[model samples]
Target: MSSSANNAVSSPFQLFDRTEWKRLNGHFSYHLSQDEVDNLHALNEPLNIKEIEDIYFPLAHLINIFIERTKDAHAVVNGFLNKHTQRLPFIIGIAGSVAVGKSTTARVLQKVLSMLPGKPRVDLVTTDGFLYPNKVLNERNILNRKGFPESYDTKLLLNFLSAMKSGVEEIQVPVYSHLEYDILENHMQDVVRPDILIVEGINVLQVNSSKGNIVFVSDYFDYSIYVDADEKDIMDWYVSRFESLRATSFQNPESYFHRYAGMDPQESLAMATNIWNEINRPNLQENILPTRYRADLILEKGSHHFVKQIKVRKI
Candidate 1:
């Protein structure tokens, strides 16, 4: 192909900011201190300077821009309505299929963005909190399939977010138990006016206009990311993560998944795959994965669990 001809066609795997993007050679000149880098490294994962520089730094940089725009918009609205200026949280939505590392992305963002100047109060909340109690799902006969849109109290979720974005001072979120796989009674997590709020879930971006609210929840997200990979790769990841958990977290008798600890490797693989195929995959294909284009950015991962491309939706 001629050099000029090559310019006419583009690779589908281009990251959102492929132009003028510079991948750090070995070490990135981050604001984090050496001690903090040590702590991040101790998270017992394989994240490195390259991933931070390429994937996350650009994201945080863009988020800063969005936050500034939000402040300007709020100022304009206040000026017109003759209302007092209130700080609004910049809402971010992280979405993906099961075991696609959206949780990992959220955790890393929570840590990195918190240290950024003028954004000391970053808070991360999972939509898992809005899930109905196990008893409710059991009664509704959807207990076998818990991650569906019907399993969550969408109305309450909306109220919490609306209050937070409307400049509410303090809001309480219900606490959930991974061990029990249910909402914990008499338990809640209270969040004040955080500078940034990252909400992660399988279907946080799904639309439900038929509900009494009749509002698109994702409209509140100033920016969003959809993690992507082939279906087969995600299944492999789910099984591998389950194996790791069974050998560790699930080993404790008090862990709700401890029952799976007794199963041998083969049996455990079968169980994990069954859960993904029966429950998680259906939810992904139906409600979650279809909304990828709705996201402001997409993190496309290869089979190796590393992001191969970052597609930032054009403005």
Candidate 2:
């Protein structure tokens, strides 16, 4: 290839300012309503239609391109094998530090991507469901390490992914209740085959080894995103989200964190800070942050939890 042609290909980790990224959205239409945006926004996190147009609209367009590319690749492989094969769900993994607004990002992506033409089916599932039951965690004496990768049942998560990718018509996933802060063993969330699957979690990009064997949750992912932000900003968001939850979900009588709801604001703030410093900060530094470079795209957030820059991994 000539030098000019070679230069046309972007190197990995190529960065784009918001304006530059927004230009890519010209090919797609934005069709989200205020009510839809409101339903998707996380408590204490700010996401507006402008943010969607600037960030996610282009992202959905990019993913749509990838989906089409995947179909072409699948057809080629099927032709080479002289057989017909079904197109499985395209898995998109979203990873980020706690309280960095990844859940909101996932919901926004699911909503926007579903609205795109082709009538694609999209489903969002968090890795929280794969967390070990509290009884098991307590038995293992790691209740305090709940969000750590070790707290998850990786084998089960892998099986679920495998089933979903194998075109299984119905797969039952464990249901986790944030209000109760535990896995509802008796309850199951059904994944009726979707065209797109968004798996959002802190450790979605993690490499796991069991019984001297290696497996990565991201191995099944066709596309991946990591939400990035300054650690201090994330800590602030964490404490703020904790406070908001105290006023909301924690107020429920059955909430595991219900005790926090009655605490004085000062006490609650201190406790939230302590949790951030002791649990989440360490997990982010040790595990989550290290995997950011692995994402196909990264949305770096700024003040008030707004995405300020976008990074697209080059082909």
TM-score top scorer: 2
Candidate 2 overall lDDT versus native: 0.90
User: Any residue pairs clashing in model 1, and if so which?
Assistant: 16-310
Candidate 2 Cα deviation (angstroms), residue 31: 1.9
175-292: candidate 1 lDDT, tens digit per residue: 8888777888999998987989999888788896456556767878988889899999988988888888888878889887899988899999999999998899899898888888
Q: Which ten residues in a row have the lowest lDDT in candidate 1?
A: 19-28
Per-residue lDDT tens digits for candidate 2, residues 1-315, read 888667656457678998999898768876778998899988899988999888888899989999999999999999999989788999999999999999999999999889888878998999999999999999999999999988999889999999988889888899899988999968998899799999999999977553464668899999999999999999999998898898889999999998888987898899999999899999999989999989999999997788888888877
Tell me model 1's lDDT, rounded to 2 decimals.
0.79
C-alpha positional error of residue 11 in candidate 1 after TM-score superposition, expressed in Å:
12
lDDT scores of the candidates, listed in order = 0.79, 0.90
Q: Estimate each model's TM-score.
A: 0.87, 0.94
